[model samples]
Target: MAANNGLRYKDKVTIVTGGSKGIGLGVVQVFVKNGAKVVFCARREAEGKEVEADLNKLGIGEALFIPCDVSKEEEIKNLIEKTVAKYGRIDCLVNNAGYHPPHMPIDDFSSDDFRELLNVNLVSYFIAAKYALPYLRKVEGNIINMSSLVGQIGQFGAVTYVATKGGISAMTRALSIDEAKYNVRVNSVSPGNVWTPMWNSGAQATPNPEKTIENGANSQLIGRYGTLEESGTACLFLAADATFCTGIDLNLSGGAELNYGIKTMRGEKELPF
Candidate 1:
């Protein structure tokens, strides 16, 4: 979809999970600037209120910060109920709350660790979508799922995170089909190496974090980490203008997801998957 000078989301109502920081914060800012009233939640009350106050002061679009722990079904249910209660209708749901624990191999994690990861990173998306679907159907709205390049092609030491992201991509496709009859579109945005606070913090866990981040930035074909703004734009495009698209995984990778040329040169003939 192409951008226009007009307010794309004028008067639209949106719900953004994890809107306290990173890509989620960017999405909230962009939507508010475009004239959509946003209801966003986070586990941290202080950060959420700070964001809410900042957005409200902008005097563009309205923003509400609801403190929530998305890992709980009741909380997600309450989030959706509160959203519809205030707005009276829901137009878009951006499922963006997820985290990757420090890079670790499969055997490093216990069953409980894996289960907790699954609950917060993956299951919450489904629960949020399930709760929002009925009202989304009423408005012919859409859902934007945040997947990752790590999910598509396994990230070396992030098996658990990769699995959850892959599940998101798969779920997005299935959901599109289920929601088609109701005219609600579903799609995923998969980002490669973004330089958000979450990414920076994760990188800091390594020895020589400066070197690690530098190596990551230089590894990108674009010679820089992807910005949260880029991801926000992709999401806004899917939500406001991708009218003909559904069940699609739109990649905003800075060539990080593409190593076909190097792989081909190395004579690798088959994909691992």
Candidate 2:
């Protein structure tokens, strides 16, 4: 179903990481359009500011851009502090910032490389949650972690990335159990082949970019790649609508995990309306 664009979250305070582009941008846009007061951060100040300015012009919600590198613990702490100081409370936190390096075999990846990837993709989420929890507890807020379908199913040539995502899903469950007493929820969204800048970059790096993209799309039961809006809407659902949900890892995989073998649209026909 299509997401409702109405102002369902009017004035709710939210923080989203990596909100300058891709799935993060989509989450920010969805939250803002739903009448939220969002503080979004990215390493790129210019892009963050641009997103903030453009979103603010919509006149539906407020957007504040903060420059941050999530790999640093201090930066994550500061981000939470600044948001709480400005908004007085945080209703939701969306941990969406992540890095997916070029595909390579496990043997080719160094321990240091794996550690660095963990810092960016997994450790940052932990740090953000550590700092944001007190405020979230105060308001009974929720967290929506951005995970990946590969975290569940395995992916070849991406052991490091898969490890990080798997950690996120595990952490989401454990954190939710710990925070449930405070009425704060923790959950995750695992997406498959979402159409984002990172995906485009990965595709472009391949020898046959078009064929690579086509294969990626065909991997899902759906005939196309998932959209940013779809990813954003899933987060919104977890944050705003799934009141009793916690420790749940929602899959936005377009049925990619269903059945076995390669997915194809062969012999498909449209049904009568």
Candidate 3:
């Protein structure tokens, strides 16, 4: 027999939560380009409709967008059910929906903010996996959880967000072991900084968008932040090509993970105070 065509997820049915925009949209774009039938979801119906139209115009494999709030178990269930109903099976699930509230000191952080962070970042993954497990198991499908470098090394003023990231990392390990026997793979991708609508939107309000981008870029050892295209490539590899990869977190942090303390200095030389 010929060698297996292992790198491609062609014709694979995929679902990406929070896919209306940002890193999630990036993942969806890549999947569509690579010949997968993909369905994505977000709570914003207008954005979802617009992206759906844009993807359809590409004439790639069919794309669908469902209105969903991944934080709620019922919504998660509906998101997966609708996807499977549309595509027949789920070969891959990309849990990419996330939120990062305004940064605040730990003591100053509200309990509500902490709960929102956990619900969106950590619990949503569990909710999606629970509903998608049956279909995923049928095809030995894979799950890719979106995480962040902040979780690995806590961000100075984002306690809640950091906690969720840390929890997802731990969850990835345990869940991977749990799903192994069922032939379903679970992995995570922790991105450093990817320039997407999310980043751009925030930058618009800043005094200097270019400087913000530059500072963000310089924080990485690679001397630049990431693009959605780059992050999407990582997602594609993890979701389809990594057959034996599970319980692992592939950090696409532009080498930021390698140099922890340097980014905080803002490319400044220390004064001999």
Count of steric clashes across candidates, in order: 0, 0, 0
Q: Give a tens-digit lDDT track for model 1, residues 1-273.
A: 525347688778999999999999999999988889999999999999999999999878899999889999999999999988898999999999999888766788888988999999999999999999999999999999999987887776677889999999999999999999999999999988888999899887887788888877866778898887787888999999899999999987888866553433245342211
lDDT by residue (tens digit), candidate 3, 218-244: 778899778877888999998877888
Question: TM-scores across all candidates?
Answer: 0.93, 0.93, 0.90
Model 1's alpha-carbon lDDT is: 0.89
Q: Please say which candidate is ahead in lDDT: 1 or 3.
A: 1
Question: With candidate 3 superimposed using the best TM-score fit, by how many Å does residue 1's alpha carbon deviate from the native?
Answer: 17
Better of 2 and 3 by TM-score: 2
CA lDDT, candidate 3, residue 63: 80
Off by over 4 Å in 2: 1-5, 262-273
Give lDDT: candidate 1, residue 200: 90
Overlapping backbone residue pairs in candidate 3 total: 0
Off by over 4 Å in 1: 1-5, 260-273
Expressed as tens digits, the lDDT of each residue in 107-148 for candidate 2 is: 889999999999999999999999999999998999999999
- Report, for every candidate in turn, its global Cα lDDT versus the true structure: 0.89, 0.92, 0.84
**Better candidate by lDDT, 2 or 3:** 2
Where model 3 places Cα greater than 4 Å from the true spot, the runs are 1-7, 204-209, 260-273
- Model number with the top TM-score: 2
